[model samples]
Target: MKRQVIVYKMEGSIVRRVIPSDNSCLFNAVGYVMDHDKYKAAELRQVIAATVASDPTKYSEAFLGKSNEEYCSWILNPEKWGGAIELSILADYYGREIAAYDIQTTRCDLYGQEKKYRERVMLIYDGLHYDALAMSPADGAPEEFDQTIFAVNPDRTIGAYESLALNLVKDQQRKRSYTDTANFTLRCGVCQIGVIGQKEAAEHAQATGHVNFQEYK
Candidate 1:
């Protein structure tokens, strides 16, 4: 998403102010300062939800009334976008090596639609002077690795890598559980009576005109 901030066009001395949005990180940061500002977070969440439902033509202002469905779908689908990266490709890109991540999922009602959205939070760095903080629910993916790949802001204002890594961990956990069940079921079936091993099972299945399982062995 293209965030905009207005600054005075002066030549020398330095003084710049940043414009805040409902979805701005400062919105969350204020929580650290106050600790009792849950109301603000709640209010911003609602406004952001609404803006998301409205589908603002310009992303500079507070994104209000936007549906989580739109946000989730937008991230998955590359055509209708806002420049944020997707979780799948993000995990594959950065989580491949470390296997560590920090991703979160939240749900909100937008335009009467309950939407489940995913966001990635991470630390981004460069061998330079300034640093940035960011939040994106997909939409801003790059062109080269577009399909399912999340986009990284050029200035590293946001972190998508951590979220990607978190997603990968969850996926792996689910897959392992599923594989365990499948293996147990196969073992039970193959060890029945005279079925001694994979080869025996295959031979019995073939001789008896049963479906010879290619994946069983």
Candidate 2:
């Protein structure tokens, strides 16, 4: 089906994705940072729980807002959620620094950064909500890569890629050179069928009498 495409502007052009809406979005986002796997999401949750359990000195009651036992109990519960604090724990666990980009405040939050990591992943905060960061070259993704971000400013600054990671840029160069490149599909929100192209997607909307739409990958 026809759908609108999304593009991100970066020094080395990259693409991003939205993730499942759940209490563990931050944790799942961290899991995505490692390898973009959903099965890893639950594993990440358990890792965070265990990390805190083993290092009470680092994640004390003050930081946890409850007794160590209570906090560990809460961590085991899926209904309970995590945030930058969890992100911090995860940053150290991964032995890499993580930056959280808050679009509302236009700032990036740092956690567990030591020199540089083989991979860099970021968590996106849209004011009141959180989403996972799924970035690759706008044109195409590489089999593997690494990154380091030099921020433009305290606000509006985003993650950056190392020169070596520029290899990903060559893979999908035509996918998104401009907003009008139109490398997206439109799916009917009601029926979830793709229409083909932008114009056709629009016509499908009118013909099928479907009002809601989501950008198809």
Q: CA lDDT of each candidate?
A: 0.29, 0.58
lDDT tens string, model 2, 45-124?
77877888888887788978887777877776765557777888787787666767655344567776544544446666
C-alpha RMSD values across all candidates: 20.5, 14.9
Structural similarity to truth (TM-score) of each candidate:
0.18, 0.57
Give stretches of model 1 more than 4 Å off.
1-147, 152-168, 171-176, 181-183, 187-217
For residues 137-170, write the lDDT of model 1, one tens digit per residue: 3344322221222233444222444344344445
Instruction: List the candidate 2 regions with Cα displacement exceeding 4 Å.
Output: 1-12, 114-119, 139-217
Worst 10-residue lDDT window, candidate 1: 123-132
Candidate 1 has a TM-score of 0.18
